[model samples]
Target chain A: MSEPFRFHTRLNLVELLGRRAGTVRELLTGIREVPGASIYHHTHRFLQQHHFLSPEPPNDFAYWISGSLGLNDIGERLASIDTVRYRRINDLRTRYVEILEEALAARRNSWPVCQESDEFHFMSCRTFIIPLPAVARDAGEFLDILGRISVNSLYYHVFESRLWLERGENDFAVWFEARGDHELAGALARLDPYTITLEGLRQEIIGLVRRHVQDR
Target chain B: MSRIDDYVPVAGASEVEELRLLAARLEGKTIRNVNSTAVGGGVAEILTRMLPLLKELGVDARWDVIKGNERFFAVTKNMHNALHGMDVPVTGDDLDFFVDVNRRNAAEMDLASDILFIHDPQPIALVERKGDLGGKWIWRCHIDFTDPRPEIWAFLKGYIERYDGAVFSAPAFSRPLSVRQVLISPSIDPLSDKNRDLGEDEIDRVCAGYGIDRGRPIVTQISRFDYLKDPVGVIKAYRMVKEHMDCQLVLAGGGATDDPEGLRVLDEVKREAEGDPDVLVLFLPPASDIEINALQRASSVVLQKSLKEGFGLTVAEALWKAKPVIASAVGGIPLQIAHKYSGILTRTVEGAAFWIKQLLQEPEYARKLGVNGREHIRANYLITRHIRDYLLLFLSLYFEKDVIRL
Candidate 1:
């Protein structure tokens, strides 16, 4: 755990996702069960900082993923796609998963094949949908996983909608900065997730995890 | 007696006459109460209101505030928490500082009354003058002592053993002391500005003054800005209710001069309530009793959501107003709230939220609780009833060996 990532970082993440993941452990555990919140968060941060975010004209999503986050093989498969042909967000998600299946094929040759229940997808009950697990050969699995999954049982049980109800806005941020978590403070100040739809969260989370993989 | 007729209206002619007759037994005895602050807090508030009435009943009642600087106040504040079983340490220097101020007060102030009432730990050391003054010293401990740390209790009991008797707000607070221990709960002066009945206009005006939408169901908690009061938890409970209904919450409180943690808790409460438009966090000034009264009267439900309390007067205040109260069952709260009878008693944030929603949802049940609550306070916890108890306690102090039953 990075000491620099303070409570403000969690607060910011909650804002970005539009709901709490429940307890700190629940949030951490939910992230762990998927791709990992820190990996996703850092990836998201790295991408936005590098101007690889969505809605930019002529932005090559394939170029952003290739060799960016430690997924060289996944990046190679993704880069083969005609980036110019992608029009809608769904087109990107569809094309993205097709490449992951190819990457999964390659990984199965090297590693023991995962059991019959390899069917994994997006699950959002609270603020966070589980990130694509590290075991996945492709980060693009996030798009498919985000497209389908049950309510996170752990997160649901620990669903803490009212944890920060005792503190003021920026109180956690100020405390983080005081504890020398300026990075966390800055990250927190940018998130405004109160009314964000699940669709909006998916894109936001996918970008983060993809960035995280690239940075790794 | 200093014009005994003043109370005849509230207590009725017979009750008032009986109280005066009880006071007649202790006639000519000068009762002096010494405490930390002259204003703010329940002890000071109760003393300010009760002393005059005691004097009116022919027991010469006087009030004196023991003086201390900020450092002294901070030390004593820690002592207060320690007494209530919080592991707030009081060092040797802190104890020395506490005694230094008490020694100065002991030398300067008049401890020459017939009955010396030392309220709480602030002036407990004044009992050091027991040998010099030889007056009957009573330590009135207005704190929750159900589970004090052994060292802290040992420290206080050293001085307590030298006193004639000890007075606690609840039976649970009474430890096995060598000195006689009496249970004397705090009381509400119905006519006091903070507890008096207010017109609907006044209630509405105060609500408007705070920018609260009075039409929405308002849940209010009136206490000092202390961590013990758990204003943060109150806001959380309010948020839980907001998830289901569009109700409003008002966390109104003031700080005592002697209390050092008030502002920090208030800031935390404000921060917790930052984005919520319906949660109103008010840091009321001293003597905002009428405003407090008006707020309580207007609130749909009142809460004394304390994590720890020493016979919470806020619960009693709300009950006296005939408002259905939701309070934690810690300390003397259960003594006042009959758990679904007079009012609902809850233990956690979810429970408090549930009760608040329940009361708001069922107005008839809420009203019934309120009506029953006011009667309960009237019969058991009013100022007049309190004075009679004190008079009886004072009379008991005169007897050396005999157990005087009221």
Candidate 2:
């Protein structure tokens, strides 16, 4: 129903190491804002096993980041230090987070400003990934924003999200109700995702969103 | 239970009667289904099974396949991938050829019926006849449209909007269309040759013919030899599993009549599978249902490693046989497998390999998943339920003005 979330920073570890932070410690300090544990473990295991065979550079966090985030290109050419030098798990974590940011950054530029579709399925290869700075004022603005783009764009942003699906519809529905959109929340609860057509449901939702948008 | 009466044992008499009552209500309406291919793929298969049953239930139903040449089919194939968001480059020539082919077919074929049902984009343009012709045209999009390429979708959207209604396999498969849209997930017939019960000897015989030893832990993917199915990815995952356990891989499938790229993809798969004696690449002939049924029953684990899929029937087929299925969590696959409950949904080759190895290592857990999987299929995926849903859809269209006094 959806794709992985877009990470914030775009620090290409390979390029960063090659240019700004050659040592793992400096790279760790640079990417400290991004937590390491969230995405590093799986990338670490993949690197531990397939890093040598993969085109992703071994010494830098770029390989782990690129591979983990499904990015097609190997990360930047920032020369990397030996992983043996940093024995602590936090060192690995920071590298992973840094590499993730690098890939995410690359993915953002990979497509058109208003993307028609996703290619490479890397960091920015998601459906409803609009970085909402704040919640919508009402249903109208929300629907207007959602409808401004293609239907696919509207889908991932609110309804068919992986995070929402994983947490179950009730939690999402409750959140919707709390946002003062009870009419939309009730409609969501009534429809079965498997059997309902988004066409019919979206019409109703857009109608409601438009109603609110005009109200303001 | 191969007959309509036979379904009573599994679906229960009352449930079958409900379908019967719905069919009875739809009795006078003539339902005509039009598609691109008649022999290969799921839409054809489902129609083949359902049309006759619909006729038996007293609703006049017919199936027709549109006419197209080699170039037209090739374009449609590309269109199929593009619709599924495969990033394939589809040009103006492709779109023109597709429309030209559909125009010719529309001129030739009699698309007349009370309800004219069009399946997928292959024959979607046929819906353009709705204005000249009089009928409730239902555009049944069986392929995944979750992330369709913008240009291709824009081209198809014109004809699609003309339909009285649309049917998607899942809500995610839907887009913002003006037509009334409903979700009707495709289903497999429990009493069909491809899904019916088979003896142990029959299972052994099918495995023996393919040189697949049934004793070993077998991970099989039953699908068309298309790139979208990712036979190469399945091999990669199989190799990963082989590194851990002494398992065998079976990539068994045949090409559809409509897909010209099948042979080239088959060659690519063979090249990818070269030098691996454990890998069994079987090109089964069409209608080899007994062989297909036997393979699913014989395998310890069934895999559907599709890069993009439109409700992989093979996944449902294997689950109906109560085999532990590990499939890509794309399209309608996740809707079938509940992840660690009925079956497992994997994202990558490594992830698929991990689950295959886990299932092979723990027979008890695999068996448990299979048991749960059978129940899930029984409740959700069998043909009887599909018939009921379709009948209801047809009746709903006809009875929209009424409050259901039937």
Among all candidates shown, the one with the greatest DockQ: 2
Name the candidate that leads on TM-score: 2
RMSD in Å for all candidates: 27.2, 16.8
* Off by more than 4 A, model 2: A1-216, B65-78, B85-112, B256-276, B399-406
Model 2 DockQ vs. reference:
0.02
Task: State every prediction's TM-score relative to the real structure.
Answer: 0.60, 0.61
Which lDDT value does model 2 have at B250? 90
* Interface RMSD, every prediction, one decimal place: 31.2, 22.1
Q: Write the per-residue lDDT of candidate 1 for residues B20-78, one digit (tens) a residue.
A: 55676687788888998887676887777777777766788888998999999999888
Tens-digit lDDT track of model 2 for B165-252: 7777854566666766666678888888898899999998888988888778888999989888999999999988888789888999
**Candidate 1 per-residue C-alpha lDDT over A1-216 given as tens digits, one digit per residue, 9 for 90 to 100:** 223211110111110121222222232233344322322232222122112112211112232233123345554565455432332323444555555555555534242222111111112111211221222223345334433422121111111211112122233233344555465545543443322322354455445545644655
Q: All candidates' lDDT scores?
A: 0.64, 0.66
